[model samples]
Target: MAPVVTGVIDAHVHLWNRATDPQPWIDPTTMAAIDRDFTPGDLERMLDSAGVDAAVVVQASNSAAETRRLLAHPSPRIAGVVGWTDLTADVAAQLDGLDPASRRRLVGIRHLVHIDPDPDWLARPDVGRALDQLGARDLGFDLVVRWWQLPLAATVVAAHPGVRFVVDHLGGIAESDDEAGWEAGWEAGLRELACRPNTFAKISGLAGLVNGGDGARLRRVVDVALDAFGPERLMYGSDWPLAELGAGAVAWRRAVDELVGELSPAERQSIMSGAASVLYGLGG
Candidate 1:
């Protein structure tokens, strides 16, 4: 096979020590398969072999300590980390609780909004107040919301003029859904969200969205995101560990490459590496 694209960064991944940590979400089908820990060494080899240079290690749990553990791994492979925190918690106090170095590695904060589908959560007094504090701190927020919840997501973005928001996994589009029309509403919402200067999007998780390796489904999703967020605000992520639910590192890279097939070389590099480098403060 031709050499896989070099210097590509799998912007999102997770490196966990299952012995010390428990992730309740790993697939039951592969529980026995992935029950063992996956270390930085495991991830580095995947990056090296898959032609990926760096990655942003996102939190698999709502633990600040998880961010610290990944940061202490002593590997240059993890360029940044998108960690979890109770955004509704005492914002200043929670930020202070983070280890100094871990906070430095943080590119953004994320809460599992996918599990909490309530539209009012976006405008809830405490949640909205906490989000304002995030904007004051100049940190990004990764919106992990479902497709049906995207309209509320747009509302949240519209309300927060200063906070930078990243919509993950194309709003978690179901791969079985027809591309053209089924995507229109969410696409419209993304386009509306993009009009806000602070909102960005990630072109990741294509593998998990499909049931049987439907590349066409992935293509439609990518096209809409690229059209909405443009190359500048868009970044690529592997959603590893989670990505293992669908495919391995090598296969994931191929799918990402194929999705961006029509882009110019520089555009591909931005989605693959450049945008993430700037966002996460990971200098090349």
Candidate 2:
């Protein structure tokens, strides 16, 4: 049976108001479930239903304005904010420009590298310098990449040992017709990336990756992640509204409980909350 875990902190949740900050990537027809705005109240209800204690809200767009709005959002459940900054520009100046309170709330930064046109965008020298700035400021970088981009991400993670990296969505498996080929590449890249001690992986977004939200397939992926990252470097994230597209937050939480059932109480606690708390500096 799964060990009971309390004070669960979801490391990857997104909140957006489409009118102010648009998510152009969201296809209205296919992604009708999450087409509307997701308010702080909505987030609270979701967390309450899923029994999640708190969450780290992640930026959905590349806009700095969106990040500011998230930082200003009066959500008590938001333990940290992972905002976005222009990696090609003066990252330090832009981040330092934020007011002190906003700065305190900020824990990390991210870019939609998966949708970026440049396949080698993460490897750019300017971006590398910007990442160095984040490290200096004691901030983390969230890597949201596609399956094929895992190796590239691994290269960057290796180069920047100072910058803490949280690999979003198990590095994200591609929905390819050639499932075996893509899975092989993803696993190989993910394992290689895990070799870096500065890196961590989120056990979120897997429900959407598997067909029919198969529990066994999800368990297999989680097991592979455990073997590579162990419970210490692994964290749980609901991926929330996006997860609604898969099995919904409550179901995903239950699935995770089942997946990690064999782990000891302390190990389960690490994945459920401990790892994220340490990574994001969420104090007890």
Of the candidates shown, which would achieve the greatest TM-score relative to the real structure? 2
User: What are the per-model C-alpha RMSD values against the true structure?
Assistant: 4.6, 3.7
Find the candidate with the highest lDDT and give its number: 2
Candidate 2's residue-wise lDDT over 147-219, tens digit each?
8899999999999999999999998876544666887888999999999999999999866744374556677
- What is the alpha-carbon lDDT of model 2 when measured against the actual structure? 0.87
Off by over 4 Å in 2: 1-6, 176-180, 209-213
Residue-wise lDDT of candidate 1 within 1-284, one digit each (tens)? 00122366777787788666687777666655566688889888878777888777777777767766765666766667777767667978877777775466667778878876565676677888888898887667888876767888888888888787888876777555655555777777777777877877887776664536566767777887888788887888877766666776677787778777788999988888777666555653
- TM-scores for every candidate against the unseen true structure: 0.87, 0.95
**In model 1, where is the ten-residue run with the lowest total lDDT?**
1-10
Worst 10 residues of 2 by lDDT: 1-10
Error of 2 at 238 (Å): 1.1
lDDT of each: 0.74, 0.87
Error of 1 at 96 (Å): 1.7
